[model samples]
Target chain A: MRIRSTLTFVVAAVAALGIVTPAAHADSTPTVRELLDKCDNGTDSCVFHPSSRTEFGGARHQVGRNANNCSTVNQNESIAWSDTTGGSNSIGITITAEYKFGEEFSVAVSATYEHTWTWSHTVTRTDTLTTPPWSVGQIFHAPQMQRVTGTYELHFGKKFYGHYYWYVNNFSATGPEDTDDAVTFFTRAMTGDERNRCPKSVSTAKEFVSTESTPAQPALVASVRPGD
Target chain B: MRRTVATLIALVAGLAICTPATASAAPATHCTLRLETGVVTCGARLAAVTNNDVIIGRVFDDQNYGGSSFTITGSHPCKNGNGRDFGVQLAKYGWANRISSLQAWGNCWLNLYSGPNYNGDHDGEFKADTPYVGPLMDKRTQSIGFD
Candidate 1:
């Protein structure tokens, strides 16, 4: 049935400002650390923007690992991870809080993106409305996918593009092909609770300065560069 | 001829991998789980779902969505386009909502996606014959078997 219970964007973001009880809202895992230091995983850190785990409604997915093979993608898919000790072959993604704008670290992140040949567009844009946001977010998500309804509170995070060869990536947006086999099979990861769902991320080092009242249509919001 | 033989081999292999050969099955029992089609807020999670002690191989009327009914057709495995099987959960069907975890005559597989029910949408096919392996809730009463 349509389980309309779970938290969404603005609600999740507002939760972040209150007493951080990630344990309750978080999907059965330790997420506090994920919010504080997202880069702990280094350059290979991950972000699953469009996930099969339907945490939203109706056939809502369970909080833990979705160890099911996706017929659509023709690959073994999973967004959850194991809690065991030794290093795992699996790669995991987590959503965390966003903070710290344009600092030395931000400069470093920006510089890293520059080195990656894929990134071409300027960080700042003139307009700012929103686009139709046609990604996996649109494909399988049960309820309608709102590109820029001003509901989502994305912090510093972006999508995890490359393999686990590094920690979290410099950029954070992704597409279907952006993922690799190593990460496609990852498990055992933790992102904080509803309060701090927007974990700090290095996706966009600088605040995307909008020129004026006329914002970039959500469609103009280009996706992030894949790898570091 | 060759293709049919290959299919047979694959089917047997999948069963061996999914279930224990010597394991005692609970004897083809039929069960159903129900959930509310409402919003989950302020503590009201999954309402309740009870099992109606039915036997194996015998299909029953799936009354999951309050009233709308559908006969359980069959069950199968979760496979890629190429046909290699993986760790997947089985899916069964009733009427509006899909039925899963079917076991009769040692034959079972998950039914993929059907468009929508009265209230919700049936996602897609899941792995078949996979064990639920949920927590063990002891039955309150003991029973004597008929000779």
Candidate 2:
């Protein structure tokens, strides 16, 4: 009976002290700030190419020695960050449009990500396109420019744990014969210290040049029948 | 007994040598297109195809060249003589003038034509990762021959 009383007393004493064991720390994943540092420092693993263009069709003939130029510039920015959250991780993406080049205006952003656990896994992607308002005079005049900006916070599930990439498809303008150019600043999940280190613009300037030309008309040819 | 054993071994070895060896099969390259949504899926090792064969998908049947897509896998020069012509086979399966997109898997070039028998106006030359032949070639394609 005395031994039982002594054990009960010890249990009561421990409960009164509120002693609790702590959990093990989770693995460390690189933050958005760290990724920005790597990009600024020019690491081989995280390199940024400033300019890209996609020409849909070759230059063709137009009226009065005019030619069609169907090319658009694409600005891409990609950063890698780690996530220790067992659930979804959230990050903010901001696009500040500094200038514009041509007539029709639109902006598109695409985010691509992959899971590291599988082999030969295809990248999953999502895209959003927006067109700001423009006036008729701005569409016709030379050196037309506009400033636009946007911010978006994206939540990624735990399945997309390894690496993530965001692409800004800034189409400043489009026409039969036209030019589009713009400067966009991008920041995502940036902390106060990281914001100061991030570059103002993730891309460089691209220019489109065209010239007038004339071509001779094709001559008509008579068809030959099998029995003729 | 030793002589008999030696003869049996020799007979077994001869049989093994005489049997015809099976030819090594080529790895399959898969290209899947979701019709309703216009989504395309391609295999990972598309760049590893080293032959001159091109695979063209056609709708079961529809006259006015409505819905179709093509994928060319394997490494080959983008020229006439080097690549085999699958145009005849495609036309037989009701694929004439119905191509919608072209997917270049390997480092090869593809030429899209507007008429069958490789005649009429030429559309354009397409390379890797080009989603579709623009609006000009989208359902207006009558024939296609890869280089």
**lDDT winner among the candidates?**
2
Residue A9, candidate 1: alpha-carbon lDDT: 12
Tell me the docking grade of candidate 1.
incorrect
Q: Per-model C-alpha lDDT, please? A: 0.20, 0.25
> Model 2, DockQ value?
0.01
Write down the C-alpha DockQ for each prediction: 0.02, 0.01
TM-score of chain B of each: 0.19, 0.43
Off by over 4 Å in 1: A1-228, B1-81, B90-147
- Model 2 chain A worst lDDT run, 10 consecutive residues: A9-18
Q: Could you tell me how far off, in angstroms, the CA of residue A87 lies in candidate 2 after the best superposition?
A: 12
What is candidate 2's lDDT per residue for A1-228, written digit by digit as tens?
000011110100000001111122123233333333333132211211111122232122111111111111221223222211111111232212221110001221110111011101121222221111110000111211222221111111111113222111121211121223111222122233432332334111112221313211111011111121
TM-score for candidate 1, please give it: 0.13
